[model samples]
Target: MAIRNVLQLGDPGLRVVSEPVADPGAPEIAALLTDLQDTLTHWRTTTTYGRGIAAPQIGVPLRVIFLHLEQPWPLINPTIIAHSEEQMVVWDACLSFLCIFCQVWRYQQVDVRYQDLQGAWHTVHAEGDLAELLQHEIDHLDGILALDRMTDIRTMCTREEFEKRYRERSPYAR
Candidate 1:
C-alpha cells in the first residue's frame, strides 16, 4: 500500500477507459484500495478538497472508486442503474485537473449497482453530494472528465478565480 501518483489532466492514462475488475476480493484489488486511501488521504491533507478518488486517477485502469465522506466507502465496478429526472448544475473540480473547476450538470439522484471488496453485489440510492461524487468517479472509469461535461467553456475557471468569482454561488464551496 502506497500513495501512488495521481494522473494529471492531459495524461494519456487518464483518458483510457478502465477495465472491469473481475474479482473484487483479489489481493491486488485490496492493495489498490489501500493505495487509493493513502493517496486520497495525502491529497486531502495537502489540498483540503478531495472527497474521493478512482483507481484510474492513480494510473490503475480498474473500475474502482474510493470515497471518504463520513467514512471510507469502496465501490468496485459501479454502474448507475437508475437516476432521477431532476438535475443540478454544480461547480466541479478534479484532482486530475487540480486547480481548475468546471460547471457541470448531474442527476440529483441515482441508484448505483456495485460490488464490494468481498465481491458481493449491492445497490445504493444516492442523492445530493453523494450522487454527484459517484457520477464524477464513474466518469473516470469511462475516460471522461468534468471538463467534458461543461455546457460552456467559459464556465471553467481556476481555483483562485472560483474562490473570488463563484464561491458564493457554488454549493461545493467550503
Candidate 2:
C-alpha cells in the first residue's frame, strides 16, 4: 500500500466519474482497497484528520471509498441501499477542499450495502456523522461535492470565516 497524492480541485482527474468495480473480488480491486486502507492509515498518523476518503480523491478512477472511523474499515464498490426520510443539515469539509465547508443537507440515516476488502458482502445501517460521510464520499464518486448538494451557495462561508472556524486545519494560510 502506498500513500497516493490526493488530487486538487483543479485536477481534471477529479471530474471523471469513477467506474464501478463489476467484480469486487478481482485482484486489482482488492489491491485498490488495500491502497485505500493505507491512505486511511497514513492520514490518521500524519494529519490527524483521517475520517473518510474516496478513490476519486486519490486519483483512483474506481467506485471505491474508505470510511475509517477510529477503527480502519474499507468500503469497496459501496452503494447506499436506503436512507431516512428525515433530512438534516451539516457543515461539510472535504479533504480535497482543505479549509472550505458548505452547509449540505443529507438524510439522518442511511442503510449501506457494500463489499469488504476480502470481497465478502456486508450491510451497515448508520446515522449522524457516519451517514453524512457515506453520502459525501458517494457523491465524490458521482462527480458531486458538498457545494453541489447545498440548497444555497450563499450559505457557504467566506474563506476568512472558514479559516476562523477551522483555524488549525485550515489550508488557506498555506
Candidate 3:
C-alpha cells in the first residue's frame, strides 16, 4: 500500500486500455485499491480537487477505480451499462493532467455494473455530479481522457485560467 505516482498526461501508459481484472478479490487488487485510495487522499489534501482515480492513472493496466465521495468506493471491472439520453457540458479536470481543464459533455445519468473487492457484482444508478464522475473514471479504463472529449481546443484552458474564468460557473462547482 503506497501512494503510487499518477501517470501524467502524455505518458504512453495513460493511453493504454486497461485489462479486466481476472479476480476482484486478488491480493494484488487489494493492494492496488489501497494505493489508489492513498494517492487520491494525498491529491485531495494537497490540491483540494481530486475526487477519484483509476488504476491506469498509477500505471496499473487494470480495470479498477477508487472514488472518494461520501466514502471510499472501489469499483473493479466497471462498465457503463446504460446512460441517459441527456447530456451536459462540464469543465472537467483530471488528476493525470492537473495543470489544465477541458470542457466536455457527459451523460446526465448512468447505470454502471461493477464488481466489489469480494468479487460480487453490483449495479449503481448515478446522476448529476456522481454520474459525471463515474463516466470520467470509466473512460480512463478505455484509454480516453477528458481532453479527447473536448469540443474545441479553445475550450481547454490552464488551471489558473479555469479557476479565474470558469470555476464558479462549472457544473461540478455546484
State the TM-score for model 3: 0.96
Off by over 4 Å in 1: 168-174
Stretches of candidate 2 exceeding 4 Å from the true structure: 158-160, 163-174
lDDT of 2 by residue, 1-174 (tens): 787777777777777898877787788876777777787677667755557889998888888998776576778778899999999887676777655667789999999888875678899998987888899999888888777788678767754586577545432222
Count of clashes, each model: 0, 0, 0
Off by over 4 Å in 3: 171-174
Cα-lDDT of candidate 1 = 0.92
Backbone clash pairs for candidate 2 read: none
TM-score of each: 0.95, 0.83, 0.96
Worst 10 residues of 3 by lDDT: 165-174
lDDT of each: 0.92, 0.78, 0.92
How high is the lDDT of residue 29 in model 1? 94
Give residue 110's lDDT in candidate 2 (0 to 100): 99
The CA root-mean-square deviation of candidate 2, after full C-alpha superposition on the true structure, stands at: 4.0
lDDT of 2 at 25: 74
Model 1 poorest 10 in a row by lDDT: 165-174
How high a TM-score does candidate 2 get? Answer: 0.83
